[model samples]
Target: MNSAFSYNFPALRGVQGGKEYFVVMVPLRLIPKIFLFDEEEIPPEHRSQRILNKSRVPDITNYMLENSKEYVFSSLTASIDGQIEFQSFSDNPNFKDLGNLIVSLDSKFLINDGQHRRAAIEEALKISPELGEETISVVFYHDYGLSNSQQIFADLNRHAVNTTSSIGILYDHRDQLAMLTKEIIAETPLLERYTDKERVSLSKNSPKLFALNHIFNTNQKLLGKKKGEFISEQEKTFLKDFWFSLIGSMTEWKQVLDKELNPRELRANFIVGHGVFLEAIGVVGNYLFYNYPSDWNKYIEKLSTIDWNRSNRKDWMGRAYGQTGRINKTNQTITLTANLIKRKLTLPLTEQEEEMENLLKQGV
Candidate 1:
């Protein structure tokens, strides 16, 4: 009865930078009502935070809608712009931080860092109202001023670094492509020794040949399945066979697996040892898999006939290496490299590849 007509939350108080802040678990249903978002045009310098990117909202909403039952959101940082009252349950110092926070209905609540999440939650609730029953934690700071709020937003984002793709794939259990990639690396005689599981870019002297996410992405191109899509045993067997036969045909990779060649030396000397080639192989393998299933291995065997030496400028200049002589990693380069590999393997190029090849010949 006491909670009516006002915003009341059971909160845990904490101190940061000598200022009191509170953490509260807010119900999704109350989110849109309690926090305010203004879409009206405001200059960036005057606003408390950057403008809401409307483009990012739908994707976030879809993710929440798809995984409403299991989705996780980190704590939203917000600023309460009114004098809110906090009542402690006990006078004991140990219990002083446990309290009820009450704010007048007229108080202004502004999100400092999670506007996208707030927007997504609102959209998700519209479609899956049951999701509104769940809660998201919000860390509330007493608003000093708009400048302070802007500073808070800056502080929150300034230190943020995105989780690396390789580590994310390594830790993901729900993503089928990641799982299959991990399984293949764990089991494959060639990849097991040379796969870097956590980092995307291998150090110049590192023994590892490729990163985990690169392998996962190559699998994505190889299988053309949605993220987290289920894999049939037959499909899994075919992928295993295809990759095994493909790698077996690469003599240098075998030499590395057999410790006859240093991984760094191979990565330095040939396009075959670069991760881009894995993607190119995946592209070529994907075309062969769906188009010429019975003869894919036969074509893959022809991989051995291609000279992969980085010095082969006629074959590799614009495809595997840039005009600057550095290895190329762009999607365009990967496609061009795949097209060259397809030709060497006596496989017909797809129309798209042929067009790209024509453009390459035209020096475009």
Candidate 2:
């Protein structure tokens, strides 16, 4: 490391909500030097106020590498704990004006937020060195002490909320599964009117029976599509046909589609209206399409015989519902539900499915 560490950043100084801070565009190459990640494992004697999540670093690094040219990140929040001097070319440094902020080599910079992004950038640069030329915005505040730094971290994260999956699908044009889900909802008669478009879960009294996010995820699982993978036209058509045939065999779904019943009533009375059952249907359909494609429709009749109402405790309680009668959506429950559907259709289980059945029998 160079002993004489100095950076002259063109910055704007402003007061936000009664606090003064500087915003500067920083090159990626200088990020690691200027900001240090306060990991959880660091000893208390050398620890800063910030807590770094090392587990998240590798995923963020992989995302950075995968979407290098198309990625966008929000501004990083940092605190400077040393001599900070601001030199203004203008006559009044107090007003909003262009200035040069300089920091001494002895200064300590601590990140209050965006430590994962900083670590990811460092790791990404090792594989793609040209990324060093890219720049990210950094917001700097003068550090008072550990207390103030901790408070800053708390205040910054207090109101953060993650984006919902359904909204992500609705607005995303990059994911092929999302596009296919939208098309299926538009074309499939049973799903057309009862699919919630903007949320991941439905309210009990909501007119919609299922969430668009669930349908997208189900299709992804059925088609064996990973995140960021493309879907072919044939696969999309197959998904449409599979969902149409499967829902056609579901009598309750048909009643709702034919205006003989209300979706809210169906949602209240049956488990089939929920996303978990739709996912189970997708799993069963995927299995049949792969193993019994020539006569997959012949097994569709089995879905009608299986009572899908939540009140059918003998059939659904231990498989789809917990002992308390609430729906269980764990992977174990999903596999068990698919196993029940498979047994009803007289379909043979794969090695993994048999293992799942054995685990269920052991009360797992």
Candidate 3:
């Protein structure tokens, strides 16, 4: 293969399983022409390629365009079936690991993962050709025929796991709701002491009162904030005051705070102890926050009057606990549970809540 017709990159050489791999930074413009995700999955081997989920590509493309100034993406993984060579910059031992990696233009490239990102870059380039100068990294592996490449794909994905929602909320800096949720936890000693900052579901004896994601989501409900909306300092203060006042009203939570009751048993047996009711209470607060303004704390105190036992069949059967005798965590259950709270507090129900009640009464 002629050097003039080869793809060239300043690549960092690495080794794994006693084989060579190279990490190269590629200009966005060359990615589509070189990888060609829309074309077919290759190695031209007898193997099934994971179909590109076309719907997902548009969202990723939009994300790139919207956050062009500050967007971040992980390196893409690819396998190259071509003649390859590395040209060292100098005889200096330090320069040995840094060099131009050259691959023949006739080589076939196979994406073992990140097909959506590749497709998205292609779509984005059509609209924002100026972004062509920007670069993305690719980790390239030498294409070994059918069996070896298949094994590489399997090993690459076998141990992969999606980050849990709570951890996502914990680490996200851009979303206002996530930041607000973190502030709420940091400001409240009770939450800081008992919140599960990583996982969503808590084991019965895990000693956590709420998951970080639950606090994030319910606060979104409380403020009626849409995605990407900014939270004002005044609103942040209101939420801070609201949580403290609301926590003050819950006797069992206070019991846990004072160590009078076991948090494990409380979480195990009570509706007030769960995030479902926090959301219901948040919905109730949305009305009170907007309607009562100065007197919402008094209305929040009314929570003390409700029985929070999971065994309260008449109140929780279809609200927090479903017909299956298990706690329900769906959005419908959150609203239905809010309806029950509204009734207990003698607060008027929204037309939508009334409609939901009517539908339930008619068994719809």
Candidate 4:
């Protein structure tokens, strides 16, 4: 028998101020691919709260092992008003990043959890000095004190109380969404350090558009079916096909963008449109790939013949929904809008183009 006994999953939902709440449990596996330290170089704090160094780091792993089954795979709501700070503890080594994670002597700086990850951060810094300056999650307890923080930590530590609610579902979906964003950012050297707040803001402010991008760009295996739904291995292969096609298509659009658009204004588009364009590419990429087109530019010329916008907005939206949008229904309006965007990429734009009419409204 395993050393630990069976325990229920933790309740992700709870109440505060007489109001019921939930915190979504986003499995690490579901987290969108992000750049992480090499496993050997990961800090102790960065290790899963469930495993590290034969349990030398701390006992957070024990809780996960014994009670992960009981933890509700849902969202929880707690008024989160703390900051994530990463401090380095080094003795003036030539490499600033090789230092340990330093928390000030202030009891307020006590770790709520994730000590191993912190250690890994130090190790990463040694190899890549730029990493020494990254922010990590933590809950400050200066005002609340150790007891309150510990209670918060204990609740987080508890793995066998899975009582999740509807709101919990939303939170969980939101987290999955965030993980996807992080994965994309990880690949872009220019955008790696973008804050979670910025990423969330971009998605929420334009949920439908972003969702369309996610569907078109992500691997099918990585796709989230809904809050708490487990991803299957088959879907992952599909997602890979989708990601490659989408990236290839973006190469053409980026050239178009460079000629007439301010890159920043198009940030959301690049974020969202990359996926939509990829879907369009997938629609025709197999043909192009097999034919061995000598020039990508010629392929773009060929793509220009396909007019997605020939259908009315409502009908186009219906198709997008029927296809990629079906998995996790975001907003149909945004989904439809994204399809039109694909048309703009593949077809010629009239001098008085459709995009001009909506661009201002969308803050694009």
Which structure among the candidates has the greatest TM-score? 1
Q: Which lDDT values do the candidates have, in the order given?
A: 0.86, 0.82, 0.85, 0.36
Candidate 2 lDDT tens digits, 224-321: 78766877787777888778777778899889888898888897788888877877877888887788877888898678988888888877888888
Candidates 2 and 3, the one with greater lDDT: 3
Model 4's TM-score against the true structure: 0.28
The backbone clash count of each candidate, in order, is 0, 0, 0, 51
lDDT of 1 by residue, 223-340 (tens): 8776768888867877889888988899888888888899899988888877789899999888888998787788888888889999899999999888888886789999999988
Residue 44, candidate 2: alpha-carbon lDDT: 55
Better of 2 and 4 by lDDT: 2
Error of 1 at 58 (Å): 4.5
* Model 4: per-residue Cα lDDT at residue 109: 27
Per-candidate TM-scores read 0.93, 0.89, 0.87, 0.28
How far off is residue 286 in model 3, in Å? 2.4
Off by over 4 Å in 3: 38-49, 54-70, 87-98, 120-130, 145-150
* Weakest ten-residue segment in model 3 by summed lDDT: 36-45
Which is superior by TM-score, 1 or 4? Answer: 1
Ranking by TM-score: 1, 2, 3, 4
Q: Compose the digit string of candidate 4's lDDT tens values, residues 1-364.
A: 1113221112223346453333332223312122122254656444322333634423333323333344221221122222222222444654433322222222122334544544443444444454333333222222243345446556776885543332232243333443444454455332333222222123434422233233323322135244324444444334344344343444433443345543333443343233343343443333333343343335444443333332333444343433343322233333343445435445433344455536534745
**Candidate 3 per-residue C-alpha lDDT over 1-364 given as tens digits, one digit per residue, 9 for 90 to 100:** 5789998889999999999999999999988888844245544456525668898998899889988999888998988988999887788997788999999989988777788899999999999999999999999999877577667778888999999999888888877778888988998999899899998877778888888878877798889997568888878888999999888889999999899987788987898777788888888888888998888888888888889988888998877877887786788889999999999989999999999999888877
Count of clashing pairs, candidate 2: 0
